[model samples]
Target chain A: MTIHHHPGKERIDAVRAFNRFYTRQIGLLEEGLLKSDFSLTEARVLYELAHRDGLTATDLGRDLGLDAGYLSRLLKKFEERDLVERATIEADARRSSIALTKAGRQAFAPLNQGSHEQVATLLERLSAAEQDRLVRAMQTVQRLLGGSAEPKIPYMLRSLQVGDIGWIIHRQGLLYAQEYGWDETYEALVAEILGAFVKSFDPKWEHSWIAEREGEVVGSVFVVHQSDAVAKLRLLYVEPSARGLGIGRRLVEECIGFARTKGYRTLTLWTNDVLTSARRIYEAAGFKLTDEERHHSFGKDLVGQNWNLEL
Target chain B: MTIHHHPGKERIDAVRAFNRFYTRQIGLLEEGLLKSDFSLTEARVLYELAHRDGLTATDLGRDLGLDAGYLSRLLKKFEERDLVERATIEADARRSSIALTKAGRQAFAPLNQGSHEQVATLLERLSAAEQDRLVRAMQTVQRLLGGSAEPKIPYMLRSLQVGDIGWIIHRQGLLYAQEYGWDETYEALVAEILGAFVKSFDPKWEHSWIAEREGEVVGSVFVVHQSDAVAKLRLLYVEPSARGLGIGRRLVEECIGFARTKGYRTLTLWTNDVLTSARRIYEAAGFKLTDEERHHSFGKDLVGQNWNLEL
Candidate 1:
């Protein structure tokens, strides 16, 4: 007897077909992309230099998500081509900043334009509503796929930056409205969260980032000053779509790094029992639950809790 | 001022992060999987060989989703390693069958086992319920990502193969139940479809295949007898997750191929107007909408349509 095959075979088959199509669609053809004048790796380095005016080798490696050794070789190729110039930063000799030469920018311009046109052409096929649906679908996919706890620091943390907050509020409001018929409370809570951050915003003492994937924001976090003795971790939120990818943990870690530089003695956050994942991240980052209270604020009873960690 | 960014930045960031994590999780380590005793290309050839024992080089290229030229090089490497042995079929000397050598099988066994273990381990981390959820989430992702139209020749049409039929019924039933609240009707329809196929199955005149991906069955289709002068296309269903990848078109094409080989002068299919996408595929494959009738059999308004194509 056949048991319930929840996802079923047809879907799996469709996925296989899609995997083939997408790989064909977006995966660059090495021969086409790599001209006689430039190797694939060399062209990538040039592209990097063209986009980022000044970056250290380490920074390049981080931004491009390339292995240091692989990036080092690619850099060497660019150096030989006279397309890239590397210089040590005067303040930190260990950091070597790379910039594109005149020729490098010239070579990069056409290639970049071609890529831009390709993307435009693909988007052109879709209507505005279809594009929106596609983008939303991609957002859902990214969240589902990216939310898992995967190692690799920069991209993981970057996935939780500022714009993600807007998406979180938008998605939460929509989902809550649909699922629980609680639009007013959901919107009110989101407004409160947004207001709290805007009121506390101080460029000198706080910074925010919204993480995006496939053109949709999925997560966000902020670092804000508390008393002179502490820095508060604020507005850390990751959408349910991006829940499993350890995006929450990475966001918390960013707050910790910012707090250390800001010279705070401790970091603190407010949450609730329902936010178990967020609480887990705080605890993993050496925070402990310090305060609790019963509350009813979004038309539902909730246990409000605070967590704190010494820097 | 930033307008709502097209392709939300947060989603892309999350996707990039997940790509990094998933690549790692799946053991896509360049050093290990790419640099084993077999070259990357050779390993790919071996994998193709293990999965399809008698595919020609061109067929192998199609199935492995590799470029013909790249696949040629890989085939050469596999030959050098004595992992693949190629021989011309007596029936068609121009075509060659590729079979794995003893060494190839030996090497493939460990690789396949390791790959299975990796996927199993990831699945093990979730509860059975969570595993089901993950699979459903994956289906959603595959549907969103894979739904695109691309063209290719249709080959063997396999209909209602065991696994494929099972998935089709399971998924169709669930979708009908969830979306239309017609569980009993859906169940009844699926049973009728299955029962018809089983009673009429004839391998000598018909063919079927269960499409498998990532070690799971995903789809199925079949072509069967009509009159002595015509063939009927039956059991053409794709899982919701696999829609948009042109599987339906492929399935239809397979039917055409079988009908041609069996000397049928025409092919026909029956479907509902609600399935516009499937109708589009039929029309694209040179089938013409011939008749339509309105009916309410399953407690809902339905338009029954018949499409036909002359060989």
Candidate 2:
């Protein structure tokens, strides 16, 4: 519990351990990367030059977070090796643009190819699905640590697969418990609903969607057959880590589309008013509050509300 | 196909992108980490000193992969700041042991605590399950890239959970296809087996154990009722990344233990000769090959073998 409010030493060590592990994994611990003659920093500098158009020493230092003196020294080494060429900028007399020379590109190509091969070798051991999982996990860590901005990776939706139900049950149970002090019953309710849905799954009338970003499941929603004319929207939830990406709204929209495609006259859902974020999403999806009742569930006194959207 | 033979530019770019993403995530691009006055390198040096005892300047330079001149200058700065005290070694006049002073520890404590809190905040958004997934994913990347040796992390076995079935099927299907050129029919067979197991799971007679290292599922085995007196071991596998970790051996042992505890007279399994790694583990665990049949399946000629262990 002490680790709850504050991270325990164990968690900190885990991060540090990962850092050490990755350093070795990437061969940063070695004198040179991928058995190349250039040091890790040198390879990084070479990479920047090989990829970017033209950069001044200041730009390189700033972008790479390198000290001015150290960067200058490294650049000098590259220059002496004929791996880089510096030309004075026409518009800026004080600045010179740095670029990879033919020799530089030649030196860099093998290193780049080696890195690619190394990563590919790592990935080849895994199945395609696991490769995706690995990439997504890396992206998750990057996103969580506030690093994913260059491409701003988008989320994708796919039909629910075999394991999603169990994950949903487990996540919903723990999430509700952590956020609202809900008990095990909420998780049991989820399992029961999902179990029945799977047991009596009608491909013609029922469908589910799971939202993923960088290969991580961020949200989910389900539509189940209720009657010939109506469909029930159930178990709509988005992960807190992926909350503001509009995944909740998107999930609702998908539900609505599927319900309409299946010729349902109305889509209805039951939820607690305590879930304000979900409420906002529901309300925005044009679901009207049709009923409200006081209920004690999940060990909390709550107002249960039913909403409906006419197709 | 070109990517398989030789990694494409995209794969190389993915690694570079991840590197960029991670650099930003860890605040290595910042002038000072966590808004502190220490550069990333300086903080790393401080961390090393605080964690270890009597490390000489040479040790720090070698371990950190820092240039001798750079390290000396940095140490000089620390000495001027009253942050580090160095003493000449008793036996060697040329070697000086570096130790952090009280002021250095004071400066480092907040930085260390800051890093811990940052990682904590990132993990807090995830449910425990998701957190475990993230950690495990990281460990997988590290292990695949040849890290994870400091503590030699061990694997553990746990009861099967909801999402595990899907993962097992997905991994098995893809792994077989990749490694043995087996087709989707193999995947379908795994799915059928897993589906039937879940649909008619008997807690008293059937049990599955998932092997996890750093929260990543590395291997699995199931002991299911072949008869009242016999238990069938199904879907025994260890990920290629997790091979040589003895997880396969452990999983087989776990099955043996469970079958004995359940009062089954024998534990048996059907496997292919192509699975030489698994065959070794079974043999090591005292399993005797009792049957073999040459079969044409999964797009290749193969020999199937059945092995059993007496309780």
Candidate 3:
């Protein structure tokens, strides 16, 4: 009896062909959208500005991966067209905020409409299940490609707003509980950390930011005052969904920058030995493992670790 | 007992930082190599010309993913520099072959040496085992990324060559033997197919191509005579290592172009039901299942499948 071998290669080839067809189709669609109203660069800038309502030119450069000089020239062009307005921030005279004009919004509305229509048309070709599969495939591609891009340390640092601290405590507590058995002591430690962060809040001396992508908050960190000589790095948490994009490194760099500007000579943070990711970020930011101690307090005993960087 | 969870989030962060570091390092190394003797674009053109040896401006455009017009300009620049020479093929005035000059070889050697040195330097930073792991990881990344690029149908077609037929048989035999428990009968079928391909070769009516990437042959296929009203596609095979890059689709497109030029109204092929990959290539190239048959042959009971495409 001859066993029929499965046609695995054929199925893979079909999928490969579909991928090629889909990419080409999408390229054509994007080109069509571009020809109608905007050049690719202008459209990208519009998309970035629309998503980030008030970003500095420097911030736009970082976010969009544009050269600073080129971006500056583009911004000048946009300003000349009266599509975007730039003004010095009253709070910080050196920094400028960029906001779209009424005409820009009017242009953006139609562009957004056309984009949505194009996406809908493409999605319409696939069955509901196929659309789901395509979206999942796109997410996989994004993860794979995004994983390859260099992680950057974001220059802009803001303060921890409402819901940010709560998220950190909740996520960390849950992850820790899941990994190590649910421990009251671990939860208590997290609460204490949260309380300390909230109690010492100083918008002028301290700051935090939730790193965002596609309108969703993915990671965050905070810089808080310790003394005139030093500042404490606190609540550095990156969500699992956003782990590979270099958000943690950016968060750590934000803390370092805040410390540097606020006249701190040293930066310090406490973590556990098991938290290798945090340790790596600290080390990459020029921190050295100055000291470490092992202690058992929670139901699941683990060694606690501390790391520091001299800014 | 508490299960210690692996630090997935942390590892991801470290990996991201490492990627940033590696890309920047590599970019700097490449720039250093360029500053000494050649511009970046010149180095790339030389590298491509060196590796391909006899590729035309058109072939370079397709392989390097450059625009034909742009590639033509670059080739003109290389010709002006006396680094490359282009000559019309003896049989066809329309076809041109490009070859690198002695100066091109001299320029390419140091660039290649610098690249090797850079790789060595990177490897030196890691332990021997880490170096091996890094190479393996890079292979995986290249495979995944290279496979994801969309395939295109080339506008020009070239006739079948000896290497093309050899690869087709070797790949088909290996893949069939591994995937199905085919024996000498399958080998016999392959031999017969090759013999028929060689016997029926016509420069004006038939075409074949050996799909290449990074100086390696990875796939091949053929178009041959059938009847006054029909043309037969044959020996379509992509090596296992290059299976996912849509090489089969390009080969089929070449065959289709040949068929159209030769005034054939229909194209067809025969295969076993187990050859799913070929089936997919046919389907994606706008073919449909036209016939199916089952027969016990070569000491094993198996069913054969036939498919066709209308021009």
Candidate 4:
């Protein structure tokens, strides 16, 4: 975050290494992508033409990041081969709209399936969970570097995505360690609870909400069924980086709404006194402190509190 | 698969759409990657120099897909800024090895960390499971497109990786559907077995083996602890494309070895009579039929057989 500070050489090397590995990994240097006759650039231009009905040379160049002169030449070649046809735009006669001919569509089809099969070939080897992880990681990479010009944390509440679970566990584990001087015992506690929750998960009686900011998950909470008439609030946390965004408040509201709709007569929760931020959220959401006890856990002797909200 | 047949134009559009989505997702088209001053190409040149020692200007040009003249100019600029030093090769006067100066590394460090943090920011939000998925998917994309000139499915076995479970299940599901018209019941059966295995996974007593060729998983088998002295072999499968490579036999052999080393007295499995290739593999692995019964399952009335190997 400090732009003026000189980062270690190792950090730069790691990034460079990742770039090289990924470039090689994605076959950007391949002589032919998907074993087709087309170069990567040609494949890209063809892909654009195949997807959209009309495009000028400028649009193709812009979308494919091609040079203006180079794109015009390539399009001219396509026209010569009868793979593309150009017509004057009705609104602006000066501009020409490029369209793929039947032959062009036919030429592009195998390449499309080839690419699909290529991805599928890789995907088939992975478990479904693995596939989700790979996609989400890609999303992460994209969201991070993409100058998305929006809030990194959009403050939106959504259904739990695949990696959100482990992320919360890891973050909660480390955040508690750093902030409260708690130990692995806290992470273990979170894991054990999540494991059981996943094992006997009843979607109707149990619901989890993930609060995301600009595609990144910042906070989360779960409402698990204790009985038909009662529910327990569990693992309410917000990343310190994403704090003060009202994400904590929104997560608690989601839990309350879910509990009401699920017909629970009462809601309760257990938290440590050191977790004042979470407590504040609960209190704001109508949860009243019911009891407090001193407990030794997570390598800390602390006051534990239970809170309840009547539905 | 047939080159003569015309692939639907929509298929090509889909692939193009994916490419556009992914490029934008990775922020490739950003004015500056990760909001640093260096262009993507400039950063790439720096990366090549940072990673490899004693590379020449020619080497950098070739490795980075840069024009020789443009690269030479970039190197000249780096020299002017005291960011790089070049030494003439003793054996070849025409070539000189380029090395990054302390200043060059300093210039690159923040950019490197910026990129790393960018990715880390994305990674921190995913659950560990989700992280695994994201990474594995990236690997899949890499392996598929990265022209690995070797066997499509080598007759070699490896320890199971993250996605092998889902891949096997999916392959088995689709293969059975195509080959024998089995329904979703078969997929459910496989999921149930794998789910139970994951729920109580023990690396010491329970082991899983995955067979891969040129970075794609082809076959897999799991040996789970039924008791301290008993092991059960479950979910043995081979990809149809990877069949006839003795992968199934090798997977069975791996299971047997794991069972023996783990000190299991016997190993057992359940399968249908319709699976002739698997039955043959089991028979070759010294498993003998212990029981057989006719049953209605997976939309077919079939004979289910129990096989066991006494270790």
Candidate 5:
């Protein structure tokens, strides 16, 4: 799933705009953060010191990405103001450790409370669902940018609800087209499949697993009864942001588990070879390649493969 | 358009997660931002000094959300390093104005380039389209959070395209449910209306305008032909994020313009009075209330009003 993009001028400009907008939104452009006397950087430093114990100047400089001279000067000022104090480490006498003094904690309390209240004020303009959407959008930005973006809640599988099918069709259509240069035909194919699945849904044998993280759908897979003894897996996909979290493998395993529990002897799936990520997940789940064929579809010449697992 | 929300534990936790994730993503948690010697705060200060001229400590403290003492200490360190120089302000003898020195600019050049390059790297992992999605998501967060969030690109109206109807239905359904506590019945009604609109679409007499900001739909309206001389406006909606931007009014005006161009003498719309924001837009657009009725719909007892405009 390595997509190499040459960002155009538009993307650069858009990102710059967002940075400016967010800076203002978060009061980073204000005289003080959250109407408090601490500058954004000062507030950050206070927050770190208040939350942790015995952090060295090196640690603060490195973690905060501050220059050593700049940080030491800032710390000295904090010490002068009686907001922080330092002690020599017993084991590492040369390295001094620093922590917030009582005054420092007192100063940080208002800053912390102010930030919480500020965010609360922002959230107050939205409904609970919109708040969720806002947070999800922010999380999406974080995930796409790449970082230690762990989902706050582990994804849980659930049955599809109203609008889920349409959402899946829309996303899959757009994603496939973007990632593989597939056309609207791919979207139409998905819509057709889902429409049929919904029209002829059988709860006893057919099931769907929509993986959700904090209410946003991150992945999904569907099990369709092919025969009394066979179940077919379809539409296995994990959102790119949600990938690398074993979601793909988990989705495959879910299909296998469900098929076995349903008393099916075999589970099968078909996918294009270009979908190497999905193929790897399937293969790792002990599904063996059973068939392959050349196909002209979605405006591309591709190799389609089928895999089967004896449940 | 005022909405009151109480931040729940879940919302607070989600925001905290986003803050932590973004802090790491932007390398605020790294030893040095962009692998430079400047901490995130130092980089920010240098950036401001480089971009602007003759900023006083007061200005820097206010604009960068830094405390006066903290900023003065930082500036003094920069002065010692020959990265910054200060001069007494002519108008205010008590104030000193600061600017980045040649050495400061030299140091800041790499930091500026590094920030740009890092954002570029993040964009490079996504396709041009995905890059657009990422920026749009960020903007959505900014808009929802409320700030000086001016749209970089003003919304434009375009004819409805594939998936627009489904998206409108989906969003309207969810939004109405969230805002008004409407039920699934509202969604079904929208689907039915859209189904009929798509089925009986007449380019000569019917039209739809979708308001788009940077490729994402922000609002939509449709003009349906009820008779040769009458045009009925249907399903007008503006996303809450886009509300204050006058999208709703623009959508209504678009409908009126299209109806007049189509030579319709009368343009009419029906909406609930409880939709105060929308009703204001209609009222300002020279629409006059023609009929009102108490009705039970979407599991809520409500007043529905019909407004008419003569072209």
Candidate 6:
């Protein structure tokens, strides 16, 4: 049961407007759906079967919101066309389970292929940036509509995976180039740092954390042994798209906790003064600026700062 | 005509999967539409009538993809209930235009409100950040689905409006606090600077540019007179959501162009070393660092750098 809210007139109108526009847009695509031989309902039924096995006609009808009689007739037509086959649900012999036949899979393959082609054609026209914006916007709608984008503990911090090192280097390189105009030298620096971290073999004294969401890596950080009693935090990074979720802070906190648990006396990190956002997080997490120097790196004259936290 | 592309099988499945998810979500809401008193089609007809000004039965049937006889009978029922009125289309005197009667509007009010409430209820469960993500995702979908989110000139530079200065201050304040963890003093500084700008206004050499997208202000920058021969750029800020789009660079360029066109010999701006992103744009646009000073501002130890571009 849903509790109701009295939304203002303008809010109601805006939503209705969105609905109208979306309906029209979907109608335009309805023409191209599943190569037009199959109606949208028929295509959808085929799609459900293609994606899942052992769904009963009752389940499909309930899921599709089709009338019982309408679904029965549609399934009958599908059976006649040899696109679907039914078998007894082993647990309840009285109930029948629905699955697409080999012919049904073949039929759906074209429709599926056509839909993908359609979306690809749609997306190809956009720049990569626009595609990102579109995808992000879609995520927003889904989230706001009580769909997938929930904010509760969005991403989990896990141990680094095999492919993560390369991904981190590539992302750091690309992102620095795009966001800060740091050139190929930045990428080179990232590669060198990550390479060095991976080349070292010490599981007891060093640890790495990778922030993952929806099977995607969003951030990473490493704590390495600088001395027997000191751990160095290195290669801290968060995806620009995933930034405001406190991933950087969490990663830094993870570093601090690991350093403490490993009996390190102090944790130290080096960063450019220009990276203010990261610096702010460090400052908040009890890291004090210990030293500063002017240097040339990544194709720019930069101010470097060292921060340390007493464990 | 759309050109066909043979996307990979995995990509096709992904699109189909999203379609299935979205269709099911929409289907979940279809139940709430008519209160079991009317079918989805009937409610949709009422919706169209409630939102739109006028439509003939033929037009409504065409728009709804309804069978002619079915729509005719539906209209007859509505007329019997005094829910709709018809009048001649004037130029096409033989045809009729349909408009909702007072009774129609009254009857539709609760349904409209219910739908609005439904969406609100869906959204109310999400965190604000999740809501932002959801809305952004929806925009993305609309853009990709050939709905809205057009890519032509995402933002336009215009003179500041009545509420823009306040909006700029509030936004800059809120954004800096959120992104950089700047304190209330930073917002106070913005207010003071803007207040000063408003007090000593010059319409000739000094100018302000507000970047507007979809009728909302996304960025702002201003040129103020430091001397008769030099123009100072001030308050250069862009909304984080709108950042990555070169608005800052364009705004700076606009300042340079305006300063030169207005016969100023040079343009200057003061920023911090920590503002690396802005600094890069300044460097790219031929601004040379002239001076640096250690200062305490925005409740932090900051390096203030002065940049000047010679016209």
Q: What share of the true interface contacts does each candidate keep?
A: 0.02, 0.12, 0.00, 0.01, 0.36, 0.14
DockQ of 1: 0.02
**Which predicted model would earn the best DockQ?**
5
Query: Residue-wise lDDT of candidate 6 within A5-101, one digit each (tens)?
Result: 3444554455555565566555656768835678899998998898888898888888888888999999999999999999987789777989999
Tell me the TM-score of chain B in each candidate. Answer: 0.49, 0.64, 0.49, 0.63, 0.65, 0.61
Whole-model lDDT for model 3 versus the true structure?
A: 0.61
For each candidate, report its DockQ versus the true two-chain complex.
Answer: 0.02, 0.17, 0.01, 0.09, 0.24, 0.08
Q: What lDDT score is found at residue A97 in candidate 4?
A: 95
Model 4: CAPRI class: incorrect
Tell me the whole-model lDDT of each prediction, alpha carbons only: 0.60, 0.77, 0.61, 0.71, 0.78, 0.75
Error of 4 at B234 (Å): 6.1
- Evaluate chain B of model 1: give its TM-score: 0.49
TM-score (chain A only) of candidate 4: 0.69
Count: clashes, candidate 2:
0
- In candidate 5, the residue pairs with backbone N, CA or C atoms under 3 Å apart (3 or more residues apart, or in different chains) clash, namely A31-B62, A39-B65, A39-B66, A39-B67, A62-B31, A65-B39, A66-B39
Best candidate, TM-score-wise?
Answer: 2
lDDT tens per residue, model 1, A1-311: 11122343444444333333334333433335545466655655666677676688887676455689988887787778777788878999787889988877877888765544444444445444344545555544344334444323323334222223334444555545554454235443553444355444566677776666444455778777778778777667665545666677877887888888887888888876876667888888999889999987656777889888888
Model 2's alpha-carbon lDDT is: 0.77
In the predicted model 2, the residue pairs found to clash are none
Candidate 1: docking tier: incorrect
The Cα error of candidate 4 at residue B236, in Å, is 7.2
Q: In lDDT terms, how accurate is model 5? A: 0.78
Report residue B36 deviation for candidate 1 (angstroms): 2.7
Ranking by DockQ: 5, 2, 4, 6, 1, 3
Off by over 4 Å in 3: A1-37, A109-311, B1-54, B62-68, B102-311
lDDT of 5 by residue, A1-311 (tens): 33356997778767865764455444442333636677777877887898888899999878766789988899999999999999999999878889998889998898787777666766776766568778778877866676434545668888876667657766787688779987656665665566567656788899999999656787899999899999999998888756767778888888888898889999988999999999888888898999999999877999999899987
Per-residue lDDT of candidate 6, residues B1-311 (tens digit): 12233444544445545556567676766778757466677778898887677688888878877789999899889889998888888889877888889998888788777877787776566544344445545544655666444557788989854445556756776677676676546655665566556546688978899999766678999999989899999989887657777899999999999998999999999998988888999999999999999998766888999999999
